[model samples]
Target: MTQIRSRPRSELFAAGVLVTATAILVAQFLTATPTAVVVGDESTRLGTVGWQFGLHDVVVIAVAACAVGASTTALLNGIGSSSATSADTTCSDTSTQESTDSTSSELLQARRQEWETVSERLASNEEQVYQAVLDADGVLPQSEIVNRTELSKATVSRTLDSLEAKNLVERKRRGMGNIVLLT
Candidate 1:
């Protein structure tokens, strides 16, 4: 495959500023007398006397400012570009997430329609909690079971314990919560 790259305006602008500053500093250093190279000295005034900022000092300060500006611009641009890169990754990931969500939703709906055909006899709360987990693609947090099934936390915990006894669900500790996985 033929690879192509695109450059952003901020990088190009920073590069231009860096190059210009470098060239000016180098040319001034090479062509000026040794006295002129001494920054902030009154010798640069040629005939003027006592405590004055000369042209050489001004040029050196301006060049330093440009170099500093270029580096800061590049650093800030890099930070902004990283966020843009993540946003691009999220846009790409959203499509795959939507497909997976839809497939899981369809499977859950079919299970809901056919739940009565199951061979095992489960309590109504157990069945509702199981359907909630199945709706979440068979992996869910225990706290979410309470929310999805509209049951109290105590009730959900008791139901989960009952389901565990029957080998219908398992709960694993995950940070501050338990992730319920269907067996």
Candidate 2:
């Protein structure tokens, strides 16, 4: 019998980044001083009352941003590299539907039926956008969805926004474009 391997359990890179960022943040806070440079007093001229960030401030901001981003990434896909392409990594073969070891085959069937039922109730534009992502196995680049639907980028974006608002789909930032995921 052929055995299927389950998803990988380690998000090494994201975890490392998170840990490093945490250390940096702690060190920064512990040593932090008044690093904000005030150009003028509170009652000074309108344009002269700006604050300039010193090196300490910039480092703190950068570390905080990195920590937030890494934590979000790890939390979302920490269980395994999400089956969704565009979250972190793409499937080795994007054209084929791979067996999901995380969920049983029967569960897959139920999920498919559930999606079909949901699709039936969506508006035309929403359905088109939703179908594009569904057809891509619950994840596709927003650009790809635009191509598949032959709809204007604006239309697809608007539809996606509506779908997201309904908690039917989610859009995640991926480089220049977003990746749409079925929720």
Candidate 3:
């Protein structure tokens, strides 16, 4: 049996740097400060406000550059080491049809059968949770969602797992709790 592997730690680290850079950029934009320059005669002082790159801007730029560099490195490595495409047919067309066409509609219908199913199985709850996270526009704890939605920890965990399985959610380890994302 073959086992699939999760993403590499390097890629995850690159993604994390990217996220941090984005957040820093946002924070800089939100709280940018203008530098004041005094220009006048000796008797009087006039303060002229000028927009100069501050510490926040520098930090944002540095973080963004690191993110870009790491991402580029990861991409180059992935491309350079990729295996050649295989032409071998692993499954017959009949099996392919049975796997995709025959079950897709049923699964879709089942996903929409009820609210709980929609919340847990379908993308409805995932969408909601994702939107909520985006609306906050910052990293939020998983407990926030659990408390807000009145969902049990297990239910929230399962929903998160389902979301991750669907490539709609990602988790980042941050101290004790994982930071969630709607990828």
Candidate 4:
């Protein structure tokens, strides 16, 4: 005997609904006849061609409506079930979690404001140099900074010196060149 694997209830219900809808539509199609209506004066041989709906069309529309309703219900039910499960799983320590999330967001906002202030005080070249350091994993060799910023080594050195004076950057001697870091 072949063993059958059971699917999720929502999926199974959706599939069954879809199959039923398709079967009904197919049966309606098999029994349907092409229909048309003519309206106007027959004596003048002038008429307007118009379509006429039959029982088959009504059945098809009803099946399509049922299929749509079933799919929508399945989708909403799945979403609701998953959300409910997640809510139950994460219900513990809700207050602490909320506080921690808010605190982290606040810290992020403060850091963004601080950076904005510092950036406003920076010269164009200084900002470029700082960005280069930040892009280099928050610490970069002086040579790498020059390469990344595409600025002259002397300009990078001056910018670094200015940043260091402002306490926005730090430099450590690494071999013949210095490695720069954002403070």
Every candidate's lDDT: 0.69, 0.72, 0.61, 0.70
Residue 16 lDDT in candidate 2: 69
Please name the candidate that would achieve the greatest lDDT relative to the true structure.
2
Model 2: per-residue Cα lDDT at residue 127 = 93
lDDT of 2 by residue, 1-183 (tens): 553333323555566667777777766666555434345567443343334556877878697877868676776765443543342244455443344333334565677678889999999999999888877767799999988999999999889878977888877788988988786
Q: Please, what is the TM-score per model?
A: 0.37, 0.49, 0.35, 0.38
Runs in model 1 deviating more than 4 A are: 1-120
Instruction: Show where candidate 4 strays beyond 4 Å.
Output: 1-113
> What are the per-residue Cα lDDT tens digits for candidate 4 across 72-146?
677556533334235545757989667666765576567656765677777899988977765554568999988
Q: What lDDT tens digits, residue by residue, belong to model 3 across residues 31-65?
A: 66776666666645456476677776787777777
| Candidates arranged by lDDT, highest first | 2, 4, 1, 3
Question: Would you give me the overall lDDT of model 1?
Answer: 0.69
Q: Compared to the true structure, candidate 4 yields what TM-score?
A: 0.38
**Model 3 Cα displacement at 61 (Å)?**
30
Q: Give the worst 10-residue stretch by lDDT in candidate 4.
A: 79-88
